[model samples]
Target: MDDDDDLTLNLFTPAIKKNVGKSLENVIWGNRQQRIKARKLLKLTARAKPTKTPTLSESQSDVYTEKSEIANNKKRKIADVSLDFDNNKRRNDGSGNVSSTPTKKLKDSLHFSSLFNSNPEIPTIDVKPVECIKEEVFSSDSFESLSLDTYMLRNLRETMKFNQMTHVQEQAIPPILNGSDALVKSQTGSGKTLAYAIPIIHALQAVRPKICRGDGVFAIVILPTRELALQSYEVFRALVKPYQWIVPGCTIGGEKRKAEKARVRKGINVLLGTPGRLADHVIHTKSLHLFKLRYLIIDEADRLFEMGFEKDVKLIIDCIKEKTLKKQTVLLSATLTNGVERLAGMSLESPVRIDVSQDETTCAVTPKIDLHINTRDNSNECSAFSVPDKLKQLFVVTPCKLRLVSLVALIADKCVLAFKKSKMIVFLSTQDSVEFLHKLFSNLFKENDSVSCMNALLSDQQQDIRKSKCLVTFYKLHGNMDQKDRTLTFTKFSTCKNGILLCTDIAARGLHLNNIQWIVQYTTPGDAKEYIHRVGRTARAGAQGNSLLFLMPSETEYVKTLSNMKINMKEIMMRNVLHNLLLLFEKLPKILENDRRPPRTYEEAATTLQIYIEKVVNDEPEMQEVAKKAFQSFVRCYSTYPKHLKSIFHIKYLHLGHLAKSFGLRDAPGGFSAGKNPIQSKKKHFYKQHPCLEIHNPKEYVKKPLSSFYEFASGH
Candidate 1:
């Protein structure tokens, strides 16, 4: 039955006992019969009796114990051997038996001691922050204070009433009023331009002596952007305007060369322009002699480096070095990064740095910017059929033009802001989409919808055509235009109410518009800085604005950084009001002349109206496909339009829509849609195009030098 029971039955069997006894009987004991019986009996008695205990000597007992210990040690060794044997048995049988003893493979495991203790390297990093040089106040009356020229005083009073003295102005002015070499770190819009203007004016007024080439340009303000130069020039001109005798002229890009040459030839006290233009005049043209130039100002110092104008700035500075009078250099900037500080050190000798941290006095009225971060399981998956439902207005940014155009087609009766060249360049994914879109709009309106494309490659005439149409303008801006012209155009387009202005980052900073209702990123920016500047254009002036980013999953880091900045965006969805609105308008005729029902109010609209709008308008299969694609692009771009009756499209009497209606257009469409842009349409174009680029040959235009007495003075 079982192994143990079988063993027991075999051991105590009667048959085994009988066989043993018979064997014993057969085997007589020692020698004779009697002896054999005795032997037999003895054997039987031995088998039946217990063995006697043997007495041993003390030494024998010790030997016995020693032998017992040796036996026990041998037994233990046998047990260890048995373990080894079992391990081998397991290996042979293919059974897994993990070894208890620890064994580290040198190649696989890293030791902490070896990693940390051997060949240790201590890394060193620089942790010092840039320091600002302290400035001391000077008595305003330390030097003879003549009743400032009545005209300059009036302008100064007005400026003081509107704006307070900036940190640069507060400290540097006394030195400038006293005539000192002052290097500064005040940024744009910080009044650095006015600081030097005031001192130059004071010096000009103090002396009534005749000026000559030996005296050079009295005051030269060097700037990187034509806009900034113009701004500075205008400020300087206004300060000295009460006294028309002190004529101050500005030479910048985008102007008639002949007109600028004529103005420079007439002689002025001050000159303002970019480095290249100013340098060309100084080196080739002898019109404005720099030999007598007393004051030199470099504005927006950091911007000079950023725009790759350092070499130009340096060259201009070198040209002025040849002047007869030792010039005083004043450098101004906002953030004195290491590179800029180094540039300053190289440009100015023993200069003082004045940093005015943003304090209570600075304007803090910029619109309240709130960032939202969307948290949902649908984080990365936006349905293709959903439009940006959370967004009222939206902009989509993309690196691919065809993608952008194709996206526009699916969204229904929406205006487009497209790049001109790319409109013609065929997209790999959506070939002929642009032309198709053009045809679609044209057919809808019985002619091409007033739509425009703008880029830097188009001709001025072409741009004008687009602008004049006021419905849509196709345009381009080349590198040739002056900075002022560029800035103005950017501002005009950005604030065009319902118009779309497609542009590059050149229009990003120092330009804010209230009318830019949405921002779109067609593609994710490669870095964080570019992203910040792009979204910055909208959501300006405290108005509720939205931005959309179309990005891939691989761009999670970029999305994270944007989220960290508090930009709340959801994956695009098609079930949105904006998407539905586009479909409705696309199917509806352009005008319903007698349907005079006031547009639905935001309150009257159903809370879930945006979703219903999508369902009702996208009822058609073909239109649904387009809606799906549009929503895909919208989600990729990070925009949303809410679905609800709370807000509806209504006609208004202002901005882009109003202008469009005035120009023979009908009611404004619902949601964030483009209206006619009026830039190229305005009568201002009738005048000779404003000189947007000023290229001066220095030989023709030069400014008169200020008096030496005032230039050398120590205080105001």
Candidate 2:
């Protein structure tokens, strides 16, 4: 061996191996030894300590600290571990010390490490992280933390996980809990239910078994519509379960009166119902005591006034009045019009008012509806003509029934389906027209296409069938079917697809249907306002859509005036209109004339009609010019028409009443009455002298009083 090689090998061999082994030991086992020694010392300290009179300070009691609690927890663990260590150490001590304390045989009743093990898998005692959860600090937090005693937590998680607390709820809950009355102005879906419900439940809990008999209820909710009442009832029922025995009941129209009374007879802590129904129960029933009613909530306040239920709502409030029964009233509304706000002011006393108009976090802000105006070609006259496509020819030569059939067939033919097919909504002039068109359209689609119908007259069973079987829902929704149902039906229609929603003016203003691509005015609207609403159905939610207006030849004047309004539409001439007119007139000669005035021989009639047609066709320039002048006269005349007359005469029939009759005009039923009373009719001289009796507002036409949280139940 070479001396240099041997020296190099000796330097690197055992020294490198020993250093490498020492590092591996330190990396893996160094911390473990320290932990074991700490455990032993902790055990010894615990054994030497006395447990009988441990000291506590003023600060320790005043505020619970995380450190103190943790130290207290470790004390127990140390005592157990210390006992084990002390026994072992004493046996090994060199001094043969005989202790006065007799040593009991140590049985492994519990493992020290098991009791103190941080790892749960090591069979250690399970100690919840109670200290980690911060104690409820504020009064509101303490109140919220109070478990919904009988109510399940799962429901809260379900409802709130998807829908966050709305603006009204966030603002109202605290004040209500603090026993303050509040007035909320928020749109639909603004969480008004929870706003009143949470505080109501809390108040009920505060005044539990002591609830006075005639002291009726802690809360009573009133709604403008039955559906809203029922919905509110369900929410209260879910929330009131936490109050254990307190039950809530609802009374509304279309339910058995006896059954409703029976439910109320069982002692209701909360009552939800429409004003009329609630009034009926209170007025006739012996059980309910308005004297004790503490909380009164009027929901949909604006709608109540709109529905002309202001009187009924006030009567119910008056009936609930009592002295010494100090109550809080909360009124909720989306839009508080003049009359509605007046009513609120009358009812609630200086209630804290909360209006969440600009809160985007809760309310849904709709996209703008684009307005497009179309000017026609070669037409100096402007009026309703902008929407001429929606109007049909005046003086239907064919029977009205057959014309309706043909119209549906035409719409069916023109409908084209693509991946995202747009739907058509036909605005009918009357319920009869809706029924006739719906049947015809349904038959046509049943054979080759898909269609549905919506109107007011169908039975509930029929409505359900249409809603489920047909993609198109046919329902006859009107202002009469109660407010709640109306809101719900419209909400549903707003979402459905490829739907032909045949609605009246009820679906026009303030209601939105997003996906409509074509709006066909089955007949011209009654007025400019009506016309705007009908056309507004199209181009909703920032989408492009078309409006087609059906017009009569004589309605040129009314169309011209509307045309001046800058609406966008085009003339869609039905090419086969002449042929269809001939077919119609061929059978309607007797009806058109109203009497058997003349029956021309067929051969002679055909020849005469041909000559007339030729003259009409040849004089197109003169005819068009005359049509323009007549239209101008109609606009001037209609502009000055009395409000009463304008309300009765549809804008399309401006100066063409006879033409409208020949074309099957449908008049609204509310305003005009052609027939006079026998006594009034007999006095012909009085009528002539009085110049037509003007409808007058009475001197006692008292404005409705509003309800406020400040004056509720107290002033009355």
Candidate 3:
């Protein structure tokens, strides 16, 4: 080597040169000796030990210094390596000792957690209902005590069977009747509709000249959804039956614009409509006059803003204000929100804030009819949010694979074979999920002789088992459906004696269905406030109701989060849900019995039902497509949860394969094709850009004659 190369080589330890060109055995031995020497040097450096040095010649001292410098450089490099090793050990195991086994790091890899417990004895904790310290406002006054016209009073007592006033009605009606702009906040199902509706009718009745069809618009009531508009229209229709001269007309988005224009030309005494449709009339329909408008009532005001109807509402308000400045405005909401406050500021003038939910004043009215039996303080009294007092809230922690069977069992046990007529609303996260489950359950509960045929093939002992003849009627409602279909579905579900309505969040707010017995959240809502609105559908008007929430083991943290929001729920074991399902199957042989042997155990029964559902999906190509779409939509919805709830509903922790099983798919869609990962697909973008627009034939878009307008309008 050159002298320069030799100088570079001296910088490293001499152990490197000694190991080079040696036998393999010698090299290994050399490395061991080098490590020993490094360790000894470390000890000497750390201890700073004094070394005896005898007097030597000048050349001898120079060579010794060079050798000592090389030794120090080697010791520093070895010390760095040792310190790194110790740091890694502590980082891996959180201790000085190294871990026995190396942990396999998984980055974006699939794995499943073992959450299913075979033990049948699952413990449950009972949640006690929290009582509010505020005094309850129990109004015993009847409707007669209010200064209402005789015909209105008669309609209230005899026609509507509403003899007594609810606490909200007792407090809100008086202020609204006094012609003061009012902001009202009460619990859901607290007679809020009638609170404003009655006052509007009463004021119109006192007009000197009796109102007629061509009297122009007297009052305009804006609602958040078309279904709510229709519902309010019905209430107005029923209330105005005594005064036939006072006409009530509805103009929502689904109906024909020409027909609504004609109604406006002829004149509507009371108009009820959704914000968008009403705003369209204000802009386009010249005959729709607000010159004589006396009242403007916005029901579900918070929902109005939440649904992105703020601009439409403001447009209608500005137009109404231009027409008349002396009108009374009533803003009503089940919950008070900042958006509602902003809306009130824009519309209401010196508004009387009558919040029966928080008001503690006692009414000095005489007791005529005791209506306390029909009312309870279950609204917002127990918590910051309000739910029906009579609602029995329950939650079940289930494994992803067992989610489908658990829901099936729960519905069969609670709705199908129950002694009384049952009405249930099953809320899903996505529209595709609602559509797929509706089809699956409809086929499973078809009114046919398949169950009887299977029972006939059984032994006489098994044949003797009694069967439930009650048929299950399934209805679906989602935003994607045509307005007419949605309206018809809502109407049919409302009137059906025993039925199940599979729906998305579109039906979560403001539509009051009669006698809703159960609310089943098949998918946990992304927002906690949504849970409050969903469960509020039941236990309405002092009637007893139940709600069941399906949750995975990973989502148990949601229960605690809800508890902090003052929403109490009792835990129901998965074992008990399965047991109830088995009992129902035993009673009703028609469900999932297709000439097959009976299940002997709960596990077997669950497996059989799962296989049966999977067959139903796979056997039909259309259903298989629906299943895939639903699965993809569900995952997309799950991943887009709000930031605060990301910890509880993380997409990384979800088992895609097991989640697909709940949708009746043998494997997840992403696993089926390497090139097409459904989770990362562009379908979500397509839906977002064209939410209400669907691809169809060119002929369908062409305008039709007036005769075929109904078919076109209904999307038939």
List the candidates' TM-scores in order: 0.43, 0.43, 0.72
Off by over 4 Å in 3: 1-138, 360-383, 447-470, 587-596, 671-716
With a 3 Å backbone cut-off (N, CA, C), the pairs that clash in candidate 3 are none
- Model 1: residue 179 alpha-carbon error in angstroms: 3.6
Error of 3 at 371 (Å): 41
Our tally of clashes for model 3 stands at 0
- Give candidate 2 misplaced runs (Cα > 4 Å): 1-154, 159-163, 205-207, 210-216, 237-244, 358-441, 448-471, 479-716
626-653 per-residue lDDT for model 1 (tens digits): 4333332222222111111012211121
| lDDT tens digits by residue: candidate 3, 407-431 | 8887888677677758999998888
Over all chains combined, what TM-score does candidate 3 have?
Answer: 0.72
Q: On a 0 to 100 scale, what is the lDDT of residue 545 in model 2? A: 62
Among the numbered candidates, top TM-score falls to: 3
lDDT of 1: 0.41
For candidate 3, the 10 contiguous residues with the lowest summed lDDT are 707-716
